[model samples]
Target: MKRILLVVLLGLISHFNFAQNPTGDWYGNLEVQPGVILPLVFHISEAEGIYSGTLDSPDQKAFDIPITNVTYTDTNLSIAITDMRLTYEGVVRSNALIEGTFKQSGLTIPLQLTREAVAIEAPNRPQEPQAPFPYTVQEITFDNKEANATFSGTITLPKVVFKGKKKLPAVILISGSGPQDRNEELLGHKPFLVIADYLTRNGIAVLRYDDRGTAASTGEFTGATSADFATDAQAAFDFLKTHPDIDASKIGFAGHSEGGLIAPMVAATNKEVAFIALLAGVGQPGDELLMDQGYLIGKAQGFDDEMLRKNRIAQEMMFTTVKEHYGDTEKIKEKLTIYLENALEQNPEMIPEGSSKEAMIKREINTLTSDWFQYLIITDPRPTLEKVTCPVLAINGSLDLQVPSQKNLTNIEESVKKGGNTDVTTVEFPNLNHLFQTTTTGSPSEYAILEETFSPDALKVLSEWIIEKTK
Candidate 1:
């Protein structure tokens, strides 16, 4: 995700016009990589004496993404997108130019803006559906009674049902981590939306919703752990089963990434679920998975195996120390600090440049104490998989660096089979990333630039698997 910006050229400039407000389309291009340039447009406007704006990343196919806040003085501009962890700072140098730096993910790159006459065209996603009359999309709210939260979402069903059909098979989509909206929108791709559209068009019912405290959902999002998220899936499962047009026994879970880990958690206890689809799910203990995830992604970014090994070892020790002193934050902090200090003393190079050993230790402590990471760091997904007696379909892409295809799929398959689950199928699609997008390299930086949002081939395989198993 390294985006080092270098100016290739500049747009035409115009005469000064200071009295005019900066309420117009300001455009800039971000060189995300060496060859890929992502164009960004900020539509700044004022309403009720407050500044507001929407951002467009044309190359990423993301248009009109809401900017949380945009405040500017007569000569300076400040814009922010809290959810995306992005911020922009600029000063109006002239009528045609606004000099700025785009900050995201700890990188600063020059992103001076130029007034654009024509709008920056967002890339077309041919597969994204245009409304007409194909499926029945119903607004919904399911009660997560266990957690005292209400989830808002949409349920898409095929408009045409067979004459003799008593109940329609259904699938509930669980998002990966973080607070995601119903569409699981990220990196300019709405994978869940594409999946729901394709599945409903093919006669499958799909339920997808916002995470707790996200969008229209109600609850505290950041304070919840993966275990708490499992209950959210269970709640959705219960609600889907109650639908008059749904076959209670045929309702299943289709979880992606961290969501995949949540699927077995729901299925293990909810016997009503008929099947499950695991997309790039965790197949090992969370600590090991984290290590592998970082290592693979680092290697993809040009890190040598020796460097990765050193970092891996260092992290392993920290994770081990944290786990050993579980539930005791004070001891965990003390031990982790000592562990980090020793590691640094042995090799000062281990500490990141411009950062101290103490700061890194504090950051590690905070991470290990978080509700989400603490639970998942040592979690073993197999234990839950063993309890899920329903039919299972686990699939991963060969090029997925986050969840390496071989070990994850193989271990998941083995764990389920050992639990006497003969109704299981596992597959790894060639050359696709964790998001199921076709790419040259599985680096996540390419996700935004790649035109293919979700591979039709992979979606077809998954949709077919779900339909078959549910039937």
Candidate 2:
């Protein structure tokens, strides 16, 4: 939900001759918070100081990044990289320990650095056999002039057989809200991969890829909006339509979460799209969804009914005011700050009894409070949906908190009907979370611990709907 840069400061002083090379491998650990430590590795040389590094995150693929601006004096050294907006300020102790704080994105997080005395090996995890689907995965890049960016991603295809006797039906997998990889599924479970395998085995081909700025893709992921992401999906659709093995007439799209919003947009312009699947997509404006999300999260965290009501009222008011003054950054910030201050004073116990007003202000301001959230609050998905003429299948999880099932499903159905399309089908899965995993108590915290893949029932519903419609 928030974008943060990781910075590590290594203070190492070298008294060696200038002619001596300053190239070697360095190791360090970054402390984003009291208990959150991220391990990192960087290599420095005299010509470029620190130029390349990798971040150690179990959930993220290892990335290659550049470091710049290295300075050393006596036992103190300072290094900074403007490109990453991070700086490492530290001292080299007599014991050869490099310690400092990594500063970036208007906050200074702590970090410690050390020389790698021996080679450090990456952890070994059991690798599953190649996906059962007869598909080939390859990286591809495309340009998006609307967003002023170029992005890269992987395309998974069913291996050609029988000398391409017939073009295969294809679908593009769109991810939900987050920095998702090409698979769009993780944590020991791959929903897209499962769908791809099932569809491929059934004689349908699939294409899945990383979002514009995630994983191997190139571009800034943080500054993007749902509309921007839609362009990325459109690019992928264009790629598939041109593939030699793909049936241009049978191309379609399937989206999850925010991806659902993108499906209609892509289908609207390309009449050739055979169909669309909206899995837990949003029907109302983003602002309404945010307030609902906040209320749900607050309630699940044990906030009383009165407290929830007050919080929702304040959030709605703030969002409404923001919508009224979209492009005026100064007025928006001033009004938001005043409203947040008043809201805190009204219910001092709303957030913790002893929390300071200043602390609360800082926390609220740090969130998505600017034009992005304002624009999102007023933008509705119905306009795009009405333009879509293809057969539509919209699904929701009854236990979803982010986008309440009843409200979202109602919106989709109403929009489709208004568009003169009576063939829309809606499904609400009981006890299922946003990710379509069946769970009694659904919460974001539960996501990191749950290992179940996308529900088989949900997949069956989708596959059946697509096959039936296309037939």
Using TM-score as the measure, the top candidate is: 1
lDDT digits (tens) for residues 1-471 of candidate 2:
122222211112233322233235556755444433346665555544433333333433445555545666555556665544567777655443566877764467766666763333322212222644356766677666666666666556667533434776778889887778877755445667666766665556778887777776777777677777888888777777788877788788999988898888888887878999999888988888898998897788677899889988988887787788876767777888898888878777754422356656755654545444555777888888888889999998898998899999999989988988888999999989988887877775455345555777898898888767765
Across 1-471, the per-residue lDDT of candidate 1 in tens digits comes to 123222222112222444546788988877666545677889999988799989987544467898878888767899977656578989888767888888875567888788973344565566667788488989999898888899999999898664577778999999998788888887557889999999988778999999999889998888798889999988888888789988888888899999999999988887888899999988899999999999989888787778799999987987887678767778887887777778788877755533456656666677877868878887989888888799999999999999889999988898898888888898889999999999878999888678788899888988898878766
Model 2: lDDT to the true structure = 0.71
Clashing pairs in 2: 9-88, 182-209, 287-377
lDDT score, candidate 1, position 321: 75
Best by lDDT: 1
Q: Evaluate model 1: give its TM-score.
A: 0.80
